[model samples]
Target: MQKFNVTPLLVMLGALGLTACGSSEQEEAPQSTKFSLGVSDAPVTEAAAVVVCFSGIQLVGNDQPPQSFTLGQDSSAADTNDLCRDAAGNVIPNTRGIDLLQLQGAASEALISNAEVAPGNYGQLRLDIAQGSYLQRLDGSRHPVQVPSNQLRLNGPTLSAGGTFSYTLEFDLRKALVDPVGIPGYFVKPTGLRLVDNSEIGHLEGLVAESFLINNQCNVNPADERAAVAAVYIYEGLDLPIAELADNGGTNTHQPYASTAVFFNNDATEYQYAIGYVDAGNYTVAISCDTTDDPENPDEVNFIVTKNITIEARQEPHQLDF
Candidate 1:
């Protein structure tokens, strides 16, 4: 997968300062602005749950004191319900545990809502992740999921007064969540995490016909035991050469921006996948029957079906079926 250099993007965004229009004589600008932030995720295989405990969220900018919000302290923030706990099964205090799996495909839980912050160009937004974060396997075994330095820092958004700006941090777990060999736990890197303006984001969801999966020699029976299942890989831009399309990990000409597993929806009597919080644009979506994709290395996988789709903000979820 293509590795995104977040530093350059953050630097560029930090430089785009919001300028206010007023008289030549400078007047006191509004001291604070309303900002809201949430988080969403893409799916990962073999895991029943991926939970991360967040203690606080902070915004840092030049010439201003960093603004920090403690989870569960804000009345407007979503209730965490003590989702995090100690190894002894005691609930951890002042931390919000979020299961990324529960937030897949356009669904999100607010971390900060309607919070007041100094109106300015912030350079960094940091998440104080606690150490007890973990991942539960399908067999019910759990392993600690560690974040380097117990924090994640992303490019902060430029806030302005008189308006509430909303954003969602998209966690593409396929790239960010890693299971290291010889290690007892998983790790989360910053590569697959993207912070996007809510106004410019869209959602994608669709069905995968059983015949299509069978034709591709995919495992159509959800009840069958398997190493992995079928999945849909999404790439930025349209008409991307099939040869260039690559899965997570290693150097590649083109890498999937996000991917999700196709699961049988018994209630709907169909198989489908939903990808949420995607930036509005044209994209090429590929269906791969061989879904044993590893983010630590490149794999020779087959893409049996491909199609182009467009995502428009505020519109209904873009539906693409195979």
Candidate 2:
């Protein structure tokens, strides 16, 4: 097994396109006017913008696509990228989601109800993931999730009658037809770090690392093997990637950083709350552990924590979280 002897570690952390007819900016005139754009998620890292395309336009950013806005990446924004970010604590750029058409309306109308809207010739977008009456009327067809909204087809210059206006879209990103996989409630094991090495990158201590499927809060049960089926990811810190660790071999990112992970103990229970293998030194340690229901009801949940943690054996295949 791998071990961390020293060094402080931290960390934790995609999209599609649409088509359009316009080739370039219109020559009608460069209308000089200050405009503002808003999406459900802003520059958690990247600057948020409304990308206008041929067939339709939608907002995207902070690692989530249009349909994924309602979805939570992690139980705690401090722990995970809110579930939007990958194991690394960085915010994935493409996660921004698109609004459904049912909620579409003029910025002028929504401003009255919204405090974020600034008074002006606004171009607001509200989407409903559902197959609403307005969506059918606007596109004149039933659009698959892959299809972009028709609003993008509308020329930006002609969008507002007034020269100055603000836009806001409150469309639903969740599919009303299917059950949500993750709800608002969830917890972690040895969250963030597990205090492994005190030197640089702590030498591997050879601790056993095990994984389990738990409810909203991370804890294992003897009779309940059902939760163990959920996928779980192991990490050193919310900010560090696994591929960079010592044994991991530095292949996690564009330019791999030195990274590694190890089993916590002889028994699989070590992976449960154990922070991987901590080096023999003084340091802060952390880990990210999560799972979701196969057919998530997005309703009730609970937490489980024990002193001597051991899992029940079962014939069913165990699932791994990516």
TM-score of each model, in listed order? 0.88, 0.19
True-structure lDDT of candidate 2: 0.23
For model 2 the local lDDT of residue 275 reads 20
Instruction: List candidate 2 segments past 4 Å from native.
Output: 1-54, 58-123, 127-300, 304-322
Each candidate's root-mean-square deviation in Å? 14.0, 25.8
lDDT of 2 by residue, 230-316 (tens): 122223233343334221112223221111221122245443211212222222222222232111133121112111111122212
lDDT of 1 by residue, 1-322 (tens): 8998899888776665322333322465446678899999988878888999988988998578888888778665556567788888888888889999889887998898888777888999999998679999888899999999999999889887667899999999988999899999999998889999999989999888888888778887576331245888999999988778898874668888888888776677788788998899999998888777779899877788679998899746888888
What is the lDDT of every predicted structure here?
A: 0.84, 0.23
Please give the TM-score that candidate 1 achieves against the real structure. 0.88
Model 1 / residue 21 / CA error / Å: 19
What lDDT score goes with residue 282 in model 2?
A: 28
